[model samples]
Target chain A: MAFMIAQRAYIKLYLINKVEQRRGYGYQMLEELKEEFKPFGYVPPQSEIYRALHELVQEGVLYRTKQLKGNDPSVDFQEIVLYHFTDNGAEKAALYKKQVKTDLDRCIGMLHKAVADNFV
Target chain B: MAFMIAQRAYIKLYLINKVEQRRGYGYQMLEELKEEFKPFGYVPPQSEIYRALHELVQEGVLYRTKQLKGNDPSVDFQEIVLYHFTDNGAEKAALYKKQVKTDLDRCIGMLHKAVADNFV
Candidate 1:
């Protein structure tokens, strides 16, 4: 099942945050991510990710930069790909962000209340 | 590669929204999603997503509920696997949300300014 319990759930959550509201977030990269130093902690598996990229490209949800490869001799290999949201997509992404944040806030609120109530 | 542009970017964005600052979002569902009726637009691939969930569990970032399947005759199928952010994780998730929101706001602001600049 492509949408197994864990993956499906994560994708739904990913969509909420990545695609649900942002105008052009259909299929693309994070707008601003500088946390590559702690790569493993912050990075997801790269192989499977490309598949999503391919689908997004086909769906017109995302566009990618011509691949750029650079060598930082002492460090591991580096390949930087730049993906940008279409104008229509970026606007939508922003709108979605608010809706998602609101939903997330509500959930956080409920969790807090549940904890306070000692309902653990 | 799992971390293809579309998938990698989305995962990074997903981590930002789902894990960066919020308390306990490591491997979980969107906090509150009642928009299931529009499954294709909002829903993601289930098979691939299961992988992320399984990994999160292995990393001790998430825990899952026993699977529960529902019967809604008209619907394709219904199965809900509830997930909860551990106490420690939820707090981190909340914190991450702020950082992400801030980063996003900055990007949005920049895009707005750039558009106004007519540099495109």
Candidate 2:
């Protein structure tokens, strides 16, 4: 995460944004992120994703509910833990999204003008 | 720059891109960046700009030309040093621009999908 802070920040925002939309299991979220970021050529490490999820839960931005995994009706099987955002988590996610949008728009717009005005 | 690595990287790419496109003066580039980034609500500091410019020169990515200022013929006038990319500088700038474009497009595209798929 430290080595790839920029990517990490965006992933964080995307993760929280997803949680706010609907409840999600940790493994599912990681799988979804892997698929979503495939086009970007990034598959975030499993450990890093888990670390981020754990941090969010610790920060009280997310809550987890444990239930039986999938459709398997085995009492011996381990339960699945799904995550949901608190109200504060949702608010924070919205803010992070907005900030990313702002900075992206700004950087892209400025780069366009700088290249055009300076180079041309 | 440490606090805003994403923004800094973009700015560095933009600056190099501009230098490769046309010869420019340090002060002029700073002014242009300020105006261009105004929409994004960032005014990159003059010192930071100078530092970046100097670093590029030190790295042999840019060269400086000292010319007497203005059309007014006066020996008392101070010389203005303008910057331009060297052959290597132009090549480096092109590479940097390409990398920035790749990451930017990736980041922006993933963000759009993440927001749309999750938030919608």
Candidate 3:
């Protein structure tokens, strides 16, 4: 499950980068994943998301930046950490994307065969 | 990946039970998995398979029985551990099979959208 979550996180970051041309914070990514899996009745917990992001950073696939979020500099702003892909991270994300697709296909095929054989 | 491995082990055991009406040892299941994934250029390591089986046993989904494999009484036979599904395990395997199918559908859908958008 951690592996799948990490893959999902990498793909999510890649999608976010492609669509928004900006980095993503952990909370935002968590919310996005939650929404994505909502139909499947699975809500990814915040801790898992944070842990996955941290793992990615550890893998040198991402770097973190701390930024304050607020329009007014005089106000006490919320601090957030944003994740950006490193050069190696970007290459890995692409590779992971392809690998994930292939894995999903194989898994689906296996499940179908199992179901057809009444093995489940 | 470990979670998936556990799931695969459960499913493989279920299939073996249905077809052969027998339980499976760790090495047999590992060889089966290796053959199954060989087309994809992936061979699961024996350690991972054993780890997954142990995890399933810990989860109360499987129980182990040590059996001697040899027809000769005078010779020392190989001791092999076979895995059998618990009552609860049988139920969980059925449930996991359905869940895996649903999860795979959602995952494939997400990947297709990502691919269509060129997000990967």
TM-score computed on alpha carbons, candidate 3 = 0.55
- DockQ each: 0.05, 0.19, 0.15
Residue pair clashes in candidate 3:
none
Query: Which ten contiguous residues of candidate 1 chain A have the minimum total lDDT?
Result: A1-10
Q: What is the TM-score of chain A alone in each candidate?
A: 0.46, 0.71, 0.74
Candidate 1 residue runs with Cα over 4 Å from true position: A1-120, B1-59, B70-80
Query: Could you say which candidate leads in DockQ?
Result: 2
Tell me the tens digit of each residue's lDDT in model 2 across A1-120.
Answer: 011125555566666866765847777888887776676677777777787778778877788898877576664577878889876877766776676665545545554554454343
Better of 1 and 2 by TM-score: 2
Q: What's the lDDT for residue A25 in model 2? A: 79
Tens-place lDDT digits, model 2, residues B6-113: 555556765785676574876778888777666556677776678777777887888899887877756547788788888788787777666666666565555555
Ranking by lDDT: 2, 3, 1
lDDT of 3: 0.59
- The per-residue C-alpha lDDT of model 3 at residue A23 equals 37
**Each candidate's lDDT (Cα)?**
0.39, 0.66, 0.59
